[model samples]
Target: MAAQAKRIIEDAVVRKDAKVGDKLLDKAFALAFKGLVYAQIWEDPVVDMEGLEIGPDTRLMCIASGSCNALSYLTAGPAQVTAVDLNRAHVALGQLKITAIRHLPNYERFHRFFAHADHKENAQVYRTMIAPHLDAESRKYWEKRDIRGRRRISYFTRGLYRKGLLGNFIGLAHLFAKLYKIDLSKVLEAETLEEQREVFERELAPVFDKKFVRWLTSQPASLFGLGIPPAQFEHLAGDERMAEVLRRRLEKLACDFEIKDNYFAWQAFARGYDRSESAPLPPYLQRANWETMRERVDRIDVVNANMVHWIGDQAEASLDRFVLLDAQDWMNNAQLDDLWGRITRASRPGARVLFRTAAEPSLLPGCLDDAILSKWRYLEEQSADLTRRDRSSIYGGVHLYELA
Candidate 1:
């Protein structure tokens, strides 16, 4: 099984020139991602929505990490949205969301199932309302029992936010913070940015700079929870100490974004959503967007496939908005060119492409074919601006590219 999983990873690597070590590392990443990586998409949808400027005419394509953003895009009234992920688990999760949106009785019930996300009744909601609407594969993925005799869907009832690889990683981070006598959750109570900064400096910063924390972050395995592949780790960790890099990013997460409405910041500091704090929820989960989401839910198609191949088969000039969301950081030069080739082929005139990277500045300048690269105008200033506003302050950069 392990060998087969490794081969799957190798075959999925778009770059033919990927080194053996890169291939092995990608295999580990693929294996981990296949299980359950993100329960919630981390890239700030607010930042992405601002960049893409989705409209009724837009046809969207994205790498569906957790499907939260793709579903969120539906609220923008795009003509169509298709999300592709190599991980079946993610695809299944997207499918389940679609099912829930379509069949659930109301927004309150839906919010309780996902955002509140920890009540035994959620399983009953799933079996009675959501399960019947799901396709066979998604249904099987959620309904299948684990060794503990618990159905995967039961995670919704046990705090779904605390479950995936990213969630567990945050939980570990909180544990480590506690070891240093710091309670990271206190960052949530700060009513102002200054207060947030003060709290972070007084509490979070000292613990983060601790020797044990620094050493743990320096190791590659420590970041697997962030869904970061070895290649991405190398990209983000270049020259600088990983501890410092993390501290800078965490500072932005804690201080730059207001805790009152920044759910991403709340999640980072508290390891859970601030339900009573007026912290804004993802658009898909917001009560106001439910009607739009339900009306357009049919437009979202979830596919489990390699993104490059999926984009390759797409019709010319059909897609208008592309959200890569840090996946390019995992690609080598050849893989990047291949992926961009497909994007260029599938993009309509005036298509806007948005992606994030683990390092500042876009990766396409020297890596992709000049012909294809020249056809898109890099929105450098806007990307820089959006990166600063990105509530999920984990990425080193946010990039926007528009067909020229």
Candidate 2:
């Protein structure tokens, strides 16, 4: 399974004809990505739902990163959600989340297991209550020991949010901040946007100017933990130095939205969701949506496969929505054409497709063949609006398209 997962990722990310340096970078990214990457997906589900117009009739196909958005979409009562990913670890994580929701005793247990993820009882609860209901593959994944000889499921007890590539990347960022005598958590204390801006300018913004920090950020490999491959790194940097681009992105994350309302910010600044009952959380973790998620948990199907291949097998005009989740940033022209071609064929009338890019503009117009691309209408104005509202602040643009 691990070998096949690596092949699938390489097929999607590694360009066969690329130069040696590019090929090496892609290979490195695939290796890093084969294991757990996103402990919690970074995209804002609320913005996703708003952009997709999710409803009871919506049948959505999304890339299952951490399964956060897929599970959250259940709250909107979608008819069905098919989440496909190239990584087996993500598939196992998604399956585990679904099983846990179905078999866990109550909302508190569920809450404690996921939200208060550092609690000591979570692993035991998983073994006793959740494991019995899990499929063998997922069960084996959690039971497996890491290089440190710790069972994978023990992450819940020790701080699940602090594991994975993204988690460790944030931890590393915090370490760098501490090295400069700046406490990143200070941004979390701001009560208003003005205060947030003040905190960012005072405590965060200037760090980008440090010569050592700028040099570190300039290396393409430095962003591997953020799931950025060499190809996407160039797009993210564009004409600016990577340090400036990172500073702008971090500024948005810190000052553009209220810390109390942005769970993405909480994860970035606090390393987990806020513990308060009123703390902002992804839709799947909110108490009001808990019953809905539980009731609709079975509506999702998790598949470990390349999304393009999986979609190719589906009947034409069958899917109503697609959430690509920055996966396109990893693709070359041929792959993009193949993906959009399948997407166009599989899309139902008025079907909406949503995705994010590392750069501000959509990557489609010039890259995808016009014959296939012309069949979909890009919602330029609405896409720009959603981009501004995305609280994650990590992506450059949130794009939406509809079958024309």
Candidate 3:
């Protein structure tokens, strides 16, 4: 068992070898992203907020991925936001944005900071304008010299935020498709609705029909790059009928979307998006919302630790909402219980939690049901709406809960 276990849990012990780790990147499906943040665009959280019937005074806590939606919450003008994550890299990503918005003279500068992130000049600007705002840890992470011996700040010299973890995984999946002789990237560049229709009809549809794609779709390990753990894969889609459900979901992703309006579709087809002032923007990107953003920016807080430890620091009934992004898939029962228990303890009378999953079903009901899990009401209809509208066509499921 010990030797078998060694093979099972070696991911953490192994240092990243681009040569070897390249093969294993998507195996973990860990969530990592940076710019043009699109987590759940179509879900329109504001609409969901309306459904939650939360008040203007509501203070919420959520995982700050790409910080887009978390910053989007500021548009609702929530009183406070406490963002938590175990990934120092992600926390670094969030802190970087919050600091940039406040310090970078204007939106163009701001855009440049992230848009042309692969540049060196951005580092100098960061060291001068943004670095002072960051904590020592983040400053260290960004300031640490890159392989070029140029500081990591050099990455921003041109201010383009490149393909991050999620972006990279999406790219890797594309390469895998190519290695396997499939091409999803070309689908994104379809110039017109007619072109897109043709591509989907020809190239995209075959991925679902092919034997290898079908086999890969059926395997739990293959979904890791999308952040589905083996347990979560089993819990969500591990059933005997999983292949059918997965096929249905993938089909929906390929065909159930309108290329023009669907941002998730765009991300799937193109690794990135075409940004414009009038474009369908995310909550965090809307310029008019910045004043409200500025006022509430100070209200947002972050913890450079795992959620369990962070939740421990909150007092009973101290929080109003929670956003645990697909991270629950990575946790076991005891960890889940500790987290939910703390969340339960810290929640107010009508607190709500927003979460996503790699599979259709949620990870909570088994442990957090009505009798034992009676403290929360799963907002199923609202969750469905969010899932349907989610601009980041990444996850298979979305869920919402109101504390009982």
Candidate 4:
């Protein structure tokens, strides 16, 4: 099944390279990520935490996932930001966020544009207000028709949250429940919060405990779609029952954060974050002083490039913050060397580099010899506390590092 999924992806994406921009392997990487895990369903608050060092002089680089985090970063006064992504869909989404924040008449329209993403009026609003600002490539990407022959932005029209990888996976799980004589759709239809909690506990909880289901989860290959590589699978199970580990993670994803406050958790369970006039905070959800954040926004420049390729393109010691989002797992040592080389060059004194991975520690240790990596201060221990508190604690760790 993994092999088949890979082939399907290669034909549809890697070979087509339909979403490839800036031609960094990240298009390839994005496809790979999509094949293994869901992309762009919700913003991970951890990424926002990793990227946010908001101040007048701060500049940051982060993955453009649906653009929510990008604007959330805008709330912080940073000199400039360079949002990058290989997925054209995500780029279009990010471009839309940038456009909406700058052009939407006020917070109300902006709220409607996103929080209530399914409104049919959004397409018109997007065309009139947000679409014009998008770069040609990104514009075309979102405007293009999907397999269902619907405009891509139509994904926002209904099942707004059901459009991303995680959404699709949950959808599949619901379908799977049908095979087991479970009516997941009915469970999902619980409209009230009390009903949702009751249904999740009573109806959905049994599937995880079935002997057959638990047996299937024992294999690493089964969860590749969730982007659990073999190494990550080991870390996740960690001497506990696979069911228990998932329970712990899901509990973290669902329960650890406040219901109204945690956007990541809301997106995971409720599809969209919130459906009200005033919405919940997004991952990079800060805008403390708009004047300062606006000035900071002006100072940033966004480019399309990957770490290794772009590092090769730059002279040394240039960047203050490097945001890597679990791409290292897809790379080899040479790639790591090149990427770190670029990090080494692009980094300024006191620069802090942040990234997340499937495992509990930095992907840098074995790939980057102690000789070279030693120069960079590992904030692993320092970040451990924050990692414990991350919204997507489904994975193992959130790591922070500072360049010496």
lDDT of 2 at 353: 96
Top model number, TM-score: 2
Candidate 4: which stretches are off by over 4 Å?
A: 1-52, 174-206, 215-244, 276-279, 283-302
Candidate scoring better on TM-score of 1 and 4: 1
Score residue 137 of candidate 1 by CA lDDT.
82
TM-score: model 3 vs. ground truth? 0.78
Model 4 deviation from the true structure expressed as Cα RMSD, one decimal place = 6.5
Which window of 10 residues has the lowest lDDT sum in candidate 3?
Answer: 31-40
Expressed as tens digits, the lDDT of each residue in 177-207 for candidate 1 is: 7778887767887778899899989998887
Worst 10 residues of 1 by lDDT: 1-10
Which residues of candidate 1, in runs, are more than 4 Å off? 1-10, 13-23
* Alpha carbon lDDT of each predicted model: 0.85, 0.92, 0.62, 0.60
Q: What TM-score, computed on C-alpha atoms, does each candidate reach?
A: 0.95, 0.99, 0.78, 0.78
- In model 2, which range of ten residues has the least summed lDDT? 1-10
TM-score of 4: 0.78
Q: Residue by residue across 153-212, what tens digits does model 4's lDDT show?
A: 776667556766556766666566777776544433455556645665776677788887
> For residues 46-126, could you state the per-residue lDDT of candidate 3 as single tens digits?
544554455567878776656666777776767788877545555667788888888877776665566435445676778
| CA deviation > 4 Å runs, candidate 3 | 1-54, 115-121, 145-151, 154-162, 176-198, 211-221, 240-251, 369-371
Candidates 3 and 4 compared: the better one by lDDT is 3
